[model samples]
Target: MLSLQLIRDKKEFVAERLSIKNFDAANLLNEITALDKTRRATQSELDELLSKANQLTKSIGQLYKAGARDKAEAAKSRSAELKEQTKVLSAKLSETVELLNKKLVELPNIPHESVPAGHSDADNETVYEEGEMPTLPEDALPHWELATKYQIIDFDLGSKVTGAGFPFYRGQGARLQRALINFFLDEAIDAGYLEYQPPLLINEDSGFGTGQLPDKEGQMYFANEDNLYLIPTAEVPITNIYRNVILKETDFPIKNVAYSNCFRREAGSYGKDVRGLNRLHQFDKVEIVQIEHPDNSYATLETMKEYVANLLRKLELPFRILRLCGGDLSFTSALTFDFETYSGAQKRWLEVSSVSNFESYQANRMKLRFKDKNGKMQLAHTLNGSALALPRIVASLLENNQTPEGIKIPKALQRYTGFDLIK
Candidate 1:
C-alpha cells in the first residue's frame, strides 16, 4: 500500500511509473483522489460540528445560571442537531476512507527507474553469467527418469497417496533434500541472518502484510474452514514477523532466514515446463528476508543478489542472473533479479532463486516503520530471496552431475551428503 500522501502529492508521477509495469493507474488515481477529497471534507464538517456543540454546552451552562431557560433549551436543541449531523458526517468519512484504501491497495508498487520496460521473461536482461554448462552424455536422463532408475523419487506412489504435483523423495533423494536444506540454512546463518522456523499456515493479515492477499490470493492454498493460507514461501511468515513493528534506527538491517515447505496452487500450469521438479504444488525452500533502512536497501539488495549467486557457484552449477523486466516483476517488488541454473539434460535454464527489493511497498502494508536519527518515523524497506529453492536446484544438480558411476555430488555438498556419489 502506498502512502496516501504520496498519491496525493505525486499522482502524475505515480501513474507514469506504474505505466512501466503496464498498469493504467490514471483512472484509479482519479477515483482515489475524489474519495480522499470527500473524506477530508466530511471530517472537517464533523470536527466543526463537534466544536460548535462544545461551545453550545458552555453557553447553555451560562444561560441556565443566569435563569435564561428558553435560551438554554434552544442551545441544547442546536447541540443535539449538531450531534446528529456529526454522526452522519463521521459515517460518510469512514466509508469514503474505506473505499479510498481499497483503491490504493489495487495499485502495484512503482518500479525503480532502473527497471527495463518489457512484456515477459524473454525480455529480461541477463546481467551476469557464471561457471560452465556441463557436457553430458547423449543418453543422460532428466532428473525424473534418473530418480526412477535409482528408485529415489516415486511420483506414482505420491500420486496414489495424494495427487499430481506431489512426489515422495525416497532413499538418496530424501537424503539429498535434507542435505540441501541444512546447507542452505547454515549458509544463511553464517551470513548474519538469524534462523527461524516459521509457521506453515498464516492468517489473512500475514498474507496481506507481504502483498500476497489480494494479488496472489488465487495462487495460495487456503484452508476454508480455518480461513488460513498455506504459505507459498517462507518469505511471507519470516518477513511478516516485523509487521506493525517500530524499530530504532540502530536496527537498520534485520536479517532472518527460514526453511519451509511452500504450497502453491499453480493453476493453469501444464506441459513440459511443469514436468518433474520444474514446478510443484509443494516445494522446499530456504528464504532469506531483510528489513533494512531505506537509505541502504538497494545496496543491500545487491549484496543479496551476489549471495545467492555464490550459493550457485559453490554448488558448481552453471548459472546466470537476470534483472527482471517491469512486466515480470512481482506486485510488491520495486526491483527483482532472478537466478537460473542450467539443467544439462533438459537443455534449459531453471529458475532457482529470485532476489528482490520491495523498497517501502511491503513496509507500508505491514506498517513496519523505524524511528530515524531525526526522530521521525519512516517506512523501512523489505527484501527477500530464495537462498535456493530445492526442487529445481536438485534437478539441475542431478542432471548436470550425472556420470557412468552415478550422480556425483558437488564438493561443497559432499560433507553434508556424506558420500561422493548417489548411485
Candidate 2:
C-alpha cells in the first residue's frame, strides 16, 4: 500500500515512477488527495469541537463547586450537544479514511528508475547470458515425450484419477524430483539462508502480505469452509513471519530459504506454451527471502541475481538473464530480473526464476518495520527469488544433457542423485 503522504507531497514523483511500470496515476492520485483533504478537515473540526467541550466542562465544574447549580446545568446541556455533533463528525472521518485507504491499495509499487520502459517480455533486456545452448539430435523429443518413452512420468493415470495438470512422477522421475529438492535446499543452506518448512495454506492477511490475494484472487485455490487459500509460493508464508514485527537495526537483513509444493489455480493461463513442465497446477520451488535495511536492499538484489546465475552455471545449462520491462514486472516489485533457460525441443526460453526487490512496498502492507538509530520505526526493504523452481529445471536438464546412452547428470548434482545417468 502507498503512503498517503507520498500521494500528497510527492504526487508528481510517484506518478513519474509508476509510469515506468506502465501505470496511469493522474486520476486515482487526485482522488486520494481530495479524500485526504476532507479527512484532515473532518478531524480538525472534531478536534475544535472537543476543545470547546472541554472548556465548557471545566467551567461547569468550577460553577458547581461555587454552588452555582443553574449555570453548571446549562453548560452540561451544551456539552451534550457537542457530543452529538462529534458522533456525526467521527463517522465522516472514518469514511474519508476508508476512501483514502482504498485508493492507496489500488496503486501498485512504482517501478524503480533503472527499470526499462516497455510493454512486454520482448522488450526485456538481456543483462547477462551464460553457457551454450545444447546440441541435440533431430530425433530428440521433449521431456513429456521422453518421460512417456522411459515410463518416468504418467499423465494419463493422473488425468483418470484427478483430471489434467496433476500428473504422476514415477520411478526415476520421482527420485529425480527428490534429488533436485535436496540439492537446491543444501545449496541454499550452504549459502547462509536458514531453512523453513512453511504451512501450505494461509489466511487472507498472509496472502495480502506477499501481494498474492487482492490482485490474483482467481489464481489461488480458496477453501471456502475454512477461509484459507492454498499458498501459491513459499514467499507468502515465509515473509509473513515478520508481519507486524518491529525489528532491531542489528537484526535486519533476515535471510530465509524454504522448499514448498506451491499450489496455483492456473486460471486464464492455457494454450500451447503451457505444455509439459512449462506450467502446472502444483510444483516444487526453493525460495530465498530477505528483509534488509533499505540501504543494502539493492546490493542484496545483485547478490541474489549472481547466486541464481551461479546455480544455473553449476547445472551446466544454457541461460540468460532478462531485466524485466515495466509491463512484464510483477505488481509489487519495483525492479525484477528473470532467468530463462533454453529449452531445446520447445525452441524457446523457459522462465525458471524471478529475483526482485520490493523496496518498502511490501513492508508497508505487512507493517514490518525496523527501528533506526534514533529509535524511529521505518519500513524495511524486502527481497525474494526462487533459488530455483523444480519442473522447468528438470526439463532443461533432461533436454540439454540428453545423450544416445541417457541423460547425463551435471557434476554438482551427480552426488545428490546417486547416479550419473537417468537411464
Candidate 3:
C-alpha cells in the first residue's frame, strides 16, 4: 500500500508515474481525496463537540453548586445533544476511512522509473543470456513423452487421484525432485540466508501482507472454511515473517529462505503452454527473501539476480534474464527480472525464476520497518526471488540433456541425486 501522505502531497506525481503501468489513477485519487477531506472534517467536528460537552459538564457542576438548577439542566440537555452528534459523526468518519483504504489498496504499485512501457512479455527487455542450447536428434522427445518412456512421471495417475495439472513423479523423477530441493536449500544456506520450513497454508493477513490477497485471489487456492490460502510461493509466507516487525539500522540486510510445496489455481490456463511440466497446480520451489535499507536495496536486487543466474549456470541450463515490462510486472513488484531457461525439446524459453525489488511497496503494506540512525522509523525495502522452481527446471534438464542412452543430470546436482543419469 502507498503511504496516504504521499497520495495527499503528490497526487499528480503519483498518477503520472502509475501511467507507466497503464493505470489511470486520476479518478481514484479524486475520490480518495474527497473521502479523506470528509473523514478529517467529521473528526474535527466530533472533537469540537466532545470538547464542548466536557466544558458544559464542568459548567453544569458549578451551576448546581451555586443552586442554579435550571441552568444545570439546560447544560445537561446540550451535552446530551452533543453526544448524539458525536456518535453520528464518528460513524461517518469510520465509514469514510474504510472506503478510502479500500480505494488505496486497489491502486497497484508504481513502476520503477527504469521500467519500460509495454503491454506484454514480448516487449520485455532481455538483459543477459548464457549457456548453450543443446543439440537434439530429430526423435528427441518432450519431457512429458520422455517421462513416459522412462516411467518417471505419471500424468494419468495424478489425474485419477486428483485432477489435471497435478502429476506424480516416481522412481528417478521423484529422486530428482528431492535432490533439487536439497541442492537449492543448501545453496541458499551457503549464501548467508537463514532457511525456514514455513507452513504451506497462510492466513488472509499473510496473503495481504505480501500483496497476494485481493489482487491475485483468483489465482490462489483458498480453504474457504478456514479463510486461509494455499501458498502460491514460499515467498508469501517467508516474507510475511517480518510483517508488523520493527528493526534497528543494523538489521539492514535481513536474509531468509524457504523451500515449500506451492499450490496455485491455474484457472483459464490451457493449450501447449500448460503442457507437461510447463505449469502445474502443485509445484516445489526454493524462495529467497531479503529486507534491506532503502539505500542499498537496488544493489541488493542485482546481487539477487546474479545469485539466480549462478544457479542456472551450475545446472548447465541455457537461460536468459529479461527485465519485465510494466504490464507484465506483478501488482506488488516495482521492478522484476524473469529468468527463463531454454527447453530444448519444446524449442522455447520457460520462466524458471523472477528476481524482484519491491522497494517499499510490500514493506509499507507489511509495516516491516526499521529505525534509521536518526531514530526515525521508515519502511524497509523487500526483495525476493525463486532461486529455482522445480517443474520447469526439471523440464529444461530432462529435455535439454536427453541422449540416446538416458537423461544426464547436471554435475552440480549429482551428489544430491546419487546418480549421474536417469535411465
Q: Could you tell me the TM-score of candidate 1?
A: 0.95
Clashing pairs in 3: none
- Candidate 1 residue-wise lDDT at 343: 99
Please write out the lDDT profile of model 3 over residues 1-423, one tens digit for every residue: 888888999999999988888889999999988988888888898898888888999999999999999999998898898889988888888899899888989888888888999989998999999999899987889999999999999999999999998999999999999999999999999999999999999999999999988778999999999988999999999999999999999987899999999999998999989999999999999999999999999999999999999999999999999999988988888999999999999999999999999999889889999999999999999999999899999999999999988999999999999999999
Model 2, CA-based lDDT: 0.90
Candidate 1 lDDT by residue in tens digits, 1-423: 888999999999999999999889999999999999988888888888888889999999999999999999998898898888888888888899889888999999999999999889998999999999799989889999999988889888888998889999999899999999999999999999999999999999999999998778999999999999999999999988999999999987899999999999999999989889999999999999999999999999999998999999999999999999999998888999999999999999999999999999999999999999999999999999999899999999999999989999999998898988999
- Candidate 1: give its CA RMSD in angstroms: 2.1
Q: All candidates' lDDT scores?
A: 0.93, 0.90, 0.93
Candidate 1 regions with alpha-carbon error over 4 angstroms? 54-77
Model 3 off-target regions past 4 Å?
54-77
Q: On residues 17-125, what C-alpha lDDT tens digit does candidate 2 reach at each position? A: 8888889998999998999889999999999998998999899999999999998899899999999998999999999998887788889998888899999998999
